[model samples]
Every structure is written in structure tokens, then in C-alpha cells.
Target: MYQVALIEDDIEIAELIKNKLNNIEFLSSIDIYEGPLTYLNSGKKAPIILLDILMPEMNGLNAIPILLEYDPDALIIMHTIKNNSETIFQSIRSGAVGYIDKQSSNIDYTKVFRSILNGGAYLTPNVAYKIVNYFQTKKNQFNSLTDRENQITDKIVEAKSYKDIADELNISINTVRMHIKNIYGKLQINSKYELIKLTKSR
Candidate 1:
């Protein structure tokens, strides 16, 4: 049996989810908190936590690290109506083990809980598709870069100045600058910072 905590500001939705979770055989208890602050202040811990994205005090994305600090072993799941790719990836990067779309009608709470307890991660089908598509798009953008542009991108990511890259590659500074500009265009990014972030994400 496992205990669970649900942090949601909407009382009606919270009660509905609690009722549904109560029917899951493996769940030993379900506690509801109106928001992240309330949950944190309670000093309670659970094996699994269902967190809402939009709330008063602190949003779910910002609460992930704090919740993990409170209980590092807790499996936090984002239960939100927001399904944008940015928010999904941010939640995952912030340490959420699962992403469940609150508007998704096909999710089986019992199965979701069981999977997390068994050391597996879960995401709603649409959310999974969005993540897959994002990587695929990034891959295509990367493949579009010419070999020279690829080399310049590597140097830029390494924080090499245009003059340094030009000297190392035995090319003129003007050539290096042009290649970098082309790399940025191919990657659809504006600056070295964005380029570095894109490379690291890959």
C-alpha cells in the first residue's frame, strides 16, 4: 500500500481526483492540499505526489525542487491541464517522474500509480507525442547544417571567439563569422547562449 499527496487549488477537482484515487487498490491514503505552500508547511511526506501546475502562492513547476528537497525519494507527477511542450519538458527537467494531463480521459490512475511505484515513468499519449516531435524537429534542424557550419557550431558551443575559431580552422575571421551566422539560421537560434542550450538539450 502507498500513501499519496494531491496539491491542487481547485477544491472541486481535488475532491474528484481524491475520490478516484480512493478506489485504487494499492493506495493506502490520499491527502489533499489546496496549494504547494500548504502541502509544504504541513511537513507531510508521501511516496507519490500529484501536483497541479497553476495555483496560488507557487506554481507546480517552481514547487518541484522544493518538494524534492522535502522528500528526495518522492515520485512527483504533474497533474495539469497545461500540455505545452515547454511546460512538459520543464517539469521533467525539474525532477517530475510523471506527467498526466488533467483533461485526458483515458488515464487510469491505478495503472499510473503502479507504474511509478514499479520504477517506470509515465506521460499522457499526447504529451509523449509532443516530446517525440520536439526531438525529431531538433534532429532535422541539426542535419540541415553544412559540415563547415557544424564545425563552427561546435567552436561556438565551446565558447571560442570568432577570431580564435578562424585561426584554429585556418580560415579568415570573415569566413568564421559567416559560418556562425549560417549555423544560427539553420538552428533557428539567435545567440551563442541559445546555441549552447540547444546542443546540451540534444
Candidate 2:
């Protein structure tokens, strides 16, 4: 059973999220915290934290590390109306694996709980599209991308042959294929078309 901690200042929003969590059969308990101090005092080991960015006493972003200090193994999910690249990056860097916007698809309890239960990240479609666009704009900034992969990316832009790219990069055709696969994973593009569209936009 997963323990979910929801920390939202708005009484209505907190109750709504709490009810959603309660509806899920996997939740052993859904604890509500109006602020970080109360949550810290409660001393709960939360598997997933559904948090709002704006709150009184302490904002969600600032409170994340404190929450981690209370429970290092916590999987915090930023569930808020604020959706933007900077916030998304900060949330990711601050140890949040998921971000869901309240403005769009907030009522989708299935997607929300599925993300919590499967140990996978989930975002509202609007937020997901923004992330995809962000990836499109900055394809090469990936710390994981290799020089060979960049060469492939250039060829991908040029619409050159994979065999040629493999030979030029002095890697086996299969190795070149693997590099492209890794590049795609880092970029979060589904297909060559998306890669072309996204990369071209850069």
C-alpha cells in the first residue's frame, strides 16, 4: 500500500486531491498537510507527495528539501497550476519525478494514481507538450549525448544515410543505430518525424 501526502493550502483543492487519492484502492492512507511544518511534525513516510507550488508559511519548491530530510525515500510530485520550463526543471532538480497542472486534465485521477503506483512520471498533456518543445529547442545540451550522436544528429538534419553516418563516425551500423536511439531517449521524441520537426525548430 502506498502512502500519499497532499500538501495544498486551498481547502477545496486539498480535499479534492485527498478524495481522489482515497478512491484509489492501493492507498493505505492519504494524509493531508496544509504546510511543511505540520507535515514534518506528522512524521509520515510518504511514497508519493502531491504538492501545490503556492502556499502560506512555505512554498512547495522551498519545502521539498525539508520534506526529503524528513523522509529521504519520498517520491514528490508537483501537482500545481503553475506550469513552465523553469518550474519543471526546478521540480526535476529538486527531486520531483512528476508534474501535473491543475488547469488542464486535473480531474484525471486515473493518470495521477497510475503515475504514483507504477513508479513512473506523469504530466498533464499541456505540460507534456511544453516539455517536448523544450527538448526540441535544446537537443544538444543533453549531458548524455556523445560526439557520435551529435554527428548523427547533423546527418539527421541533412537527411543523410544511416550507413553513411555510421561509416563517417567510424562506428558499426548497429552502433550508430544505438546512438540514435539514445539520442531519441534523451530528447524524448517518439519518431523520426517528431525528431525532424523538433530538431528543425531549433
Candidate 3:
């Protein structure tokens, strides 16, 4: 069983997220902290920590290191509305391995939990886009993509679904997915969000 901790100030949002986690099969318990100060003083730890960015007391960005100091193994995932590149990079720099948008229309709980369970990283499409854009401006090292892969990537950045990309490119849906998988492998990213991010950056 996995223990999960949530440090969020918004009562409604906290409850909503808590309920969502409750449905997960592996999660045994959840502890909610309204602020960083309380979370730090509680001496409680969990394998996974879902933290919010804005709070009345100590914000999530500042709390990342402190949580790690308390428990070095804790996997912190920034669960927030802030999708800007700077904040996303700051969270990663501060120690968060994953960033999820609470405001996204579709939040894949299974993918999120599976990523964390596998010790991998998950980034919402918007957040991933910013990171891709940032790196694209710094250095264009991902020039190995094939032309078909590039076409699919462009459609992805435009927020097209697999069916849309396949239809537009006169290819099968499996072909589109295959190109996306190849793109992810070449770019060292996991989700379509990250792929879209990279395409938009280009």
C-alpha cells in the first residue's frame, strides 16, 4: 500500500483531490496538510506527495526541498494551476519530479499514478510545452526526427487528436501513434503533452 500526502490550502480543492486519490487501488492512506509549516512539524511522511503551488503560508515551490529534507525518498508532484515555463522549471529545480495541472480538462489519474509508481515523471501538456519551448530557444539538439514524425508532432502541438492527425496526414491512427512513440523515444519524453511541447517549441 502506498501512502500519499497532500498539502493544499483550498479546502474544496483538497477534498476533491483527496476523493480522487481514494479511488486508487494501491493508496492505503492519505494525509492532508493545509500549510507547509504544519506538514513540516507533523513528522509524517509518504511515498508520494501532491503539493499545491499557492497557499496562505508557505508556498509549494518553497516547500519542495523542505519535504525532501524530511524524507529524501518522497516523490513530490506539483499539483497546481500554474503552467508557466518558469514556475514549471522552478518546481523541477526545487525537487518536484512531476507537474500536473489541476485546471486541465482531462486529468489522467491512472497515467499519473502509474508514472509515479514506476518512478517516472509526468508533465501536463501545457507545462511540457513551456519546457520544450525553453529548450528549443537554448539549443536545437532534436534534429533526428523524420519528416513524418515532424508532421505528426506539428499536429500534436496544434492540439490535434490522433484521429485528427491521421486523417489530416492520410495515415492510419496506428501510424500516427507510432510516429508519436518514436518522437517520444528520440526526445526522451513520455506523454503527448511533452511531445506537443517539443513540436510547439520548434
Candidate 4:
């Protein structure tokens, strides 16, 4: 079971997300906060955080740096009304794991919640597609790798453990390790931490 923190000012929106998350398979619990600072003060390593962009005291974008300081691995999903490039880029740069728009309530929040609950991520289709295109345009840095290597590299970027990667890739654990070792050598990074930072920063 995963414990999720929800920080949104709109009570209705907050409740909606809570209800959606509560129905998710892995999310057994969700702690809702109507303000950004309240959730920030909780100081818990919630795998998922739904944070609103506009809030009293500290906005979500401003609060992101502080939240990262509290839990570097926190998977924060910007719960906001805005979907502009400026807001999206700032949130993504500040280490938000994903984005969710209140105005986008008409969409399938279930899929969004489920994706984030799992090791994958979520954003509205348009936003997510743009982000993917952005990443793809910048994927030239990884062009040195073959197709298989690229897939393995993406799994590594997602922070999958070697055994889990093997299971997902339908390969032997030893083969996974070999691929990982080769990935490390090719990427010139020795640790998962380094791989994530390097890939995500690009």
C-alpha cells in the first residue's frame, strides 16, 4: 500500500483527487491537505504528492524546492489549473515527477492516478505528448546507444532495480546486470542516482 499526500486549495478538487486515488489499486491511503505549507510541514516521504500551483503562503512552484529538500525522492505531481509552458517547465525543472490540471477534470483522472501510483508518470495527453517530444528532441545525447540500449536506458532512468528491469524486459537477471553494467560504462555513470540526474536534466 502507498501513502499519498494531496495539497490542493479547492476542497472539491482535493476531494475528487482523494476519491480517485482511494480507488487506485496500490494507493491504500491518501492524506489530503488544503494548503501547500501544511503538506510541506508533514515531512513524510509520500511516493505521490498532488500539489496545487496557486496557494496561500507559498505557491506550489515555490514550494517544490523546499519539498525536494524534505524528500528528494518525493514524486510530486503539480495539481494546478494552468498548463502554460512557463508553469510546466518551472514545475518540471523543480523536480516535479508529474503534472495534473484541475481544468482537465473531464479527462480520466483514474489513468493519471494509476500511472503515477505505479512507477510510471502522468500528465494531460497534450502536455505529456509535448514533454515527450521535448525529451525526444534532446534524446540526441543518447543516440550513441542502439534501440535495445535506449530502452534499457529509459528503464534505468525510471529507477527500476536490475531484477525488476529483467522481469519487465523478459530477460535473465544476469543479462539485466550485464546490460546495466554496460549502460553504466556507456553512460559513464556508476550509480542509479547519477543516471537519473543525468537523463532527467537533459
Candidate 5:
């Protein structure tokens, strides 16, 4: 059995989740906090933390790092109504291991907790679809580029000069410039900074 901490500003919702967690066999206990500040002040560490995004004190996104700092081993899961791709991706980038949509009807506390405990991740079906779609879109964007254009994109992302790329590819500098221009067009990016951001996001 594992202890869990839930940080949500809504008292009613917090109690609801706590009741559901109470029924999970793997969970030994559940502590509900009205906000991140209360949880952080408590200095209590749990193996799993269910966090809500919108709160009067501090948003869950910003609280993620602080919570992790307090207990690096805690598996934080975003339990919120916010299901947009940007928020989902941002939560993941901020160190959350799972994203659960509060409105998802298929939430199985047992399965979710078990999966995370066994070194896996959990995402609501809609959330998972959004993540998959994002990668597919990124893939399609790359696929639109020719093989040579793709190569030049990599070189540019590596901070290589146009002349150096030309020397390595055995092409003239102007040819290298042309390929880069095509890459930028295909990727719909204006500069190396954007190119780097796009690639890193993938």
C-alpha cells in the first residue's frame, strides 16, 4: 500500500477524490490539501501526488518543480479540467508523470496508481489522443522536407555555418543556402531559433 497526497483548491472535489482513493486497495491513505502552499508547508512526502491546475495560491504547473524539490521521488499526476495540448505538454515538461482529465468517465484509480507504481504512465484517452496527434503532426511536417533539406535542417539546428554545411555535404554555399531556405519554408519557420525550437519540441 502507498500513501498519496492530493492538492486541490476545491474542497468538495478534493473530498470526492479522497473517497475514490480510499477504495483503492494499493493506496494505504490519502491526504487532501486545499492548495500547493499548504502541502508544501506540511513537508509531508508521498509516493504519489494528485495535483489540480487552477488554484488561487499557485497554479499546479508552477508548483510542480517545488513539489518535486520537496520530494523528488513523488510521481505527480495532473488532475484537472484543463485538457488543452499546450497545458498537457507543459505539465509533462514540468515533470508530471501522468495527466488525468477530471472529466474523464473511465478513470480507474486502481489501474492508474498501479501503472505508475510499476514504472508506467497514465493519460486519459482524449489526452493520449492529443499527444499522439501532436507527434503525428510533427512527423508530417518533417516528412514534407526532402532528404537533403532534412540534412541541412539538422546541420542548422547543430549551429553549423552555411559554409561549413556546404563543405561537409560537398555542395556550394549557395546550394546549402537554397536547401536551408527550402527547409525553412517546409517547416514554416523563419529562423534557426525557430528551427531549433521546433526540433527540440519534437
Candidate 6:
């Protein structure tokens, strides 16, 4: 029986996945870890790891490398409710081999298991669509900005203060303020930090 390690913080969700996997046709065993930190300290190894992305202390995305360090051959599949592009892309960037949506009504456990066994990556249809749309939206966001708005955004990325931006652009501080407000609204971001993060992600 193959051993699968499940690192999930939520007891109910963990139990649900455990029960489902337990009933599968393959002869397998599952070990549950409430958090990745605990799993790391335990010094146990499994060939496959079903990791949760939104855990309490150390999230699954952050745990991928550490887990891989311990066992380089482990197949790490991310399990999460997050269907957003950022989370999905970042999880892949962090070295997760597969992604599973816990909220999919038609989530096929058997197919997920089979895909892993066959050396294929598995992603729910919704997740696949989100990843495609996200890249499309990244391109659209560039066209969404006005020329002046784009310039202001560049200044903001350079850590320019409002007054400094105003002086450089030969505009009043109030003009810079209005432009910043418009930029924030168009970008769908709340703070300078988020703005920086969004641009950096692009």
C-alpha cells in the first residue's frame, strides 16, 4: 500500500479527504498532519503529499520547498478553496506538481488519483479556466490604464511621495492625488503595498 501524507489544518476537511481516499480501490495509507511545521518536525516521509494551502501557521505554498527538501521525489499536490489566478500560479511557482479544488461539486477523486499515478498533472476545469483568464486579464490591465495613469503608477512603484510625483510631473499635489485615486480604482487595489505587489506579479 502506498502511503500518502495529508497536511491540512482543518480537522473536518482533513477527515473528509481521508475517508474519501480510504474508500478508493488502490491499496494505500494516509497520514494526517495538522500543520506543515509539525510534519516537518516529525521526520516522517511519504511518496505523495496532499497539502492544504490555507493552514494556520505555515501555509502549504510555503511548505512545498521544505517538504521537497526532505524528500525530493515526493509528489506534492495543493488542495485549496482558492480559485484565484494568483494563488494558483504562485503555488505552481512554489513547486506544487498538481492543484485540486476542494469546492468543485464534480471533483473526481478517482481521476485525481489516477492522474498522479500516470505521471500527469491534474487540475479541475474551473482551475484551468482561471489560470488562462488570469493571464488574459494581466494583458487587459495594461490596456485598461490611461497613459497618464500608467506614468503615475510607475512613479508610485519608485516610492515617490505625492509631492515629489507632483513636482516631477509638473502637476499640482491635488492633481497627483486625484490621479492616484483613479489609479487605485482602476487597479482594484487598496494600498500602495498592494499596488506594488500587483505590479510585481505582472
Worst 10 residues of 2 by lDDT: 136-145
lDDT of 5 by residue, 71-170 (tens): 8899999999999999999999989999999999969888888889999999989999999998888889998989888888888888999889999999
- Over 56-145, each residue of candidate 2 has an lDDT whose tens digit, in order, gives 879899988888887888888888889988898788888887788887754676667776568787777888899898875675555457
In candidate 2, list every pair of residues with a backbone clash. none
Please give the CA lDDT of all the candidate structures: 0.92, 0.80, 0.85, 0.78, 0.91, 0.85
Q: Model 3 over residues 1-202: C-alpha lDDT tens digits?
A: 9988888999888898889888888889878999878888888878899999889899889889988998999999999988888899889998898999889877887689789789789998888888888787534546778888777777788888899988898989998888888888888889987766656655
* Best model per TM-score: 1
Clashes of each: 0, 0, 1, 0, 0, 0
User: What C-alpha lDDT, on a 0 to 100 scale, does residue 89 get in candidate 2?
Assistant: 79
TM-score of each: 0.91, 0.65, 0.67, 0.60, 0.82, 0.69
Q: How much is the lDDT of residue 47 in candidate 5?
A: 89
lDDT of 3: 0.85
Q: In model 5, where is the ten-residue run with the lowest total lDDT?
A: 177-186
* Inter-residue clash pairs, candidate 4: none
Ranking, TM-score, top scorer first: 1, 5, 6, 3, 2, 4
Candidates 3 and 5 compared: the better one by lDDT is 5
Error of 1 at 120 (Å): 1.4
**Residues 86-178, model 4: lDDT tens digits:** 689899888987887667647675677667657787788777766677676556556666677778879877778778888888999898778
lDDT of 6 by residue, 37-138 (tens): 888788888888899988887978878888889889988889889878888988888778789888988677778877987888889889999988886786
Candidate 1 to truth, TM: 0.91
- The C-alpha stretches of model 6 lying farther than 4 A from their native spots are 141-202
